[model samples]
Target: MTNAVFHWPVSSLVQITDCHLLATPDALYQGIKPYHHLRLVLDELRAEAPLLILTGDLTEDHSADSYTLLQQLLADWPAPVFLLPGNHDERGALDQLSQQPPFRPERRLALPGWQLWLLDSKGDTPAGSFPVPRLAELECWLNEAGHQQIFWFCHHHLLPVGSFIDRFDQQDKAGLLAMLKREPRLRGLAHGHCHHAYQYDLPEFVQVGCPASSVQFLQTPDWQTQDQGPRACRWVFTPDGRLQWEFLQF
Candidate 1:
């Protein structure tokens, strides 16, 4: 590990998630339209060329057509794209389209001196639950990197973003938190699924919720409410290990 911290870093990174791109015939959302504004966001981010970390939900119905559309959308990205699995995304489809291994291991990579750990929190069913072995593996990874700056990406949020979302939250919150407590090097935890941009300050780290690239969720209490707007985010990672995030309105 490099103990050297540069006063100025040249490279940066961005984390995106919850890009629910649904096609026709997806029973879950029938008439729901696609968020067209994502195009504008993609155009802007393409200029920065930062490490685009897609947390989950690449497609709405997990259909091949949706994946095709997603491919076209990100075809021109200038940076390395890392995708994780979401509840809506079919693992088989993602593995096939992304052609990368699943995010189920606890290993260290030379990511500009910042450790990136992608944990699989998507349960077998729609409800989110941390798989036993995966959870244990993540805990061990965190413990090993005692105070090295790290960024964790998962499909499910460890905390309840809201009541409607609470039901779909990660089941092993205590276990996740316990592991976080042991790692003082944890910089932040970012995820997707709530369809809204939110940040929660935990005792161990900051919880960042990225907005959906396709649509925005209504902030009202009524679940029946809906909003049609394109959204995205650009996360700038400084060399000294400071992160700055900005939401892009499409």
Candidate 2:
């Protein structure tokens, strides 16, 4: 996210993540079908939106064809949607799919009251990192647009959420925290992949963890069966520049 070409808020934004849709309709992922739940969430998203962001893990099967199905599902949607590739994704396929209409794949958004920097943290494994390039890009954005209140978005958590899955927290979290200390313009952040909802405060901003659109993984990282439920995370920025978030469970 080097620069921001768009200006101001259009409408409320909905973030859908960890959909894990399959290539086949009858496919079972960890015994749960996420595409069905995705449809239900879409039905609930009938309201107007300025933008919609699918924060990755879009397909458990990682089938390039699944994006075609997703395109058809979003064919009638009016608001532009962007994508962020997750660890489970093949970036080549997603990059190609996003170049088409409706999926802009834009990284920087300057809302009426907020500036959004969407980062891709897909590293070598489920755990994520802000690699040299990623960190450099962020520094560039902050240098140019940091005067505006900023909200950072990514596919993985920045810090451990105190559960077993803490193992999957960003490997370079210490670096991230120090960078945040240096950039005072950033106000908050939101992320997906934890499969659980959380709200926590940092020294300067708040961090939110979105619930998954498929099964909810056990908060404790230990080997457990799973928790079943699907939901979408909504970010509401008011006229006063208040960034509020709530999980809409389907």
Candidate 3:
């Protein structure tokens, strides 16, 4: 072995999520017309060339045309893109679009000094679920990994976002929480499917949710009406592992 030491810093990471691709004959749509907004956001971030992680819910439905459109949209991303599963997505279609190798749903990447665990918690059925075997498998793998820090990426929210969506949460959330409690090296957790950006403080890790690149949920309305918010949200990790986030409103 050589004396070279691998250095992985925060600036190398960026995550975008919830680009629910709904196909139209001429273009794509998401209720509020967000394609142009998303393109602008990505265009700005392209210069930095950070490692991009797309959390989940890539398509509104498991349609071939939608997947193909998504592939075309992301074909020119400046940085490498990694994807996970979401409730509305089809594993087969997503894999083809991402050009991911056929192996397991989970993705384990070893960066210079950081470990990225992209978990596929979406079962065959709708919503999300984590059977005992999958939970145990993740635990075992975490035990074998070593890095300066670790970031957990998934499609479903581990905790309840709100009453409306809580019913769709992963069944084995308690099991996952137990694992998180013990894994002190877990620096952060990034996920999608909530369609909103909400950060939570767990026991030992920072849990940050990304907004949908297409449409977002209105938190509290001014006139008792819930309207769709514009697309936004991207994160920047510094070279020393510090994370900064910003939301772009188009």
| lDDT, model 3, position 91 | 74
lDDT of 1 at 97: 51
TM-scores for candidates 1 onward, in order:
0.81, 0.92, 0.80
Q: Give the Cα-based TM-score of candidate 1 against the true structure.
A: 0.81
Best by TM-score, which number? 2
Q: Please give, for residues 88-156, the per-residue lDDT of candidate 1 as tens digits.
A: 887677665554322212223335446767666777776677767777776667666645578777878
Best model per lDDT: 2
- Of the two candidates 1 and 2, the one with more favorable lDDT, higher being better, is 2
Write model 3 residue lDDT over 75-134, tens digit each, in one string: 776556677878888877766655532212337655645667787889766567888887
lDDT (0 to 1) per candidate: 0.66, 0.77, 0.65
lDDT of 2 by residue, 35-54 (tens): 77787777778665447888
Structure candidate 3, residue pairs in collision: 10-237, 10-238, 10-241, 11-237, 11-238, 11-239
Q: How much does candidate 2 score in TM-score?
A: 0.92
Model 1 off-target regions past 4 Å? 1-10, 24-35, 100-109, 143-147, 224-228
Query: Where does candidate 1 have its weakest 10-residue lDDT segment?
Result: 1-10
Using lDDT, rank the candidates from best to worst: 2, 1, 3
Candidate achieving higher TM-score, 1 or 3: 1
Give residue 85's lDDT in candidate 2 (0 to 100): 80
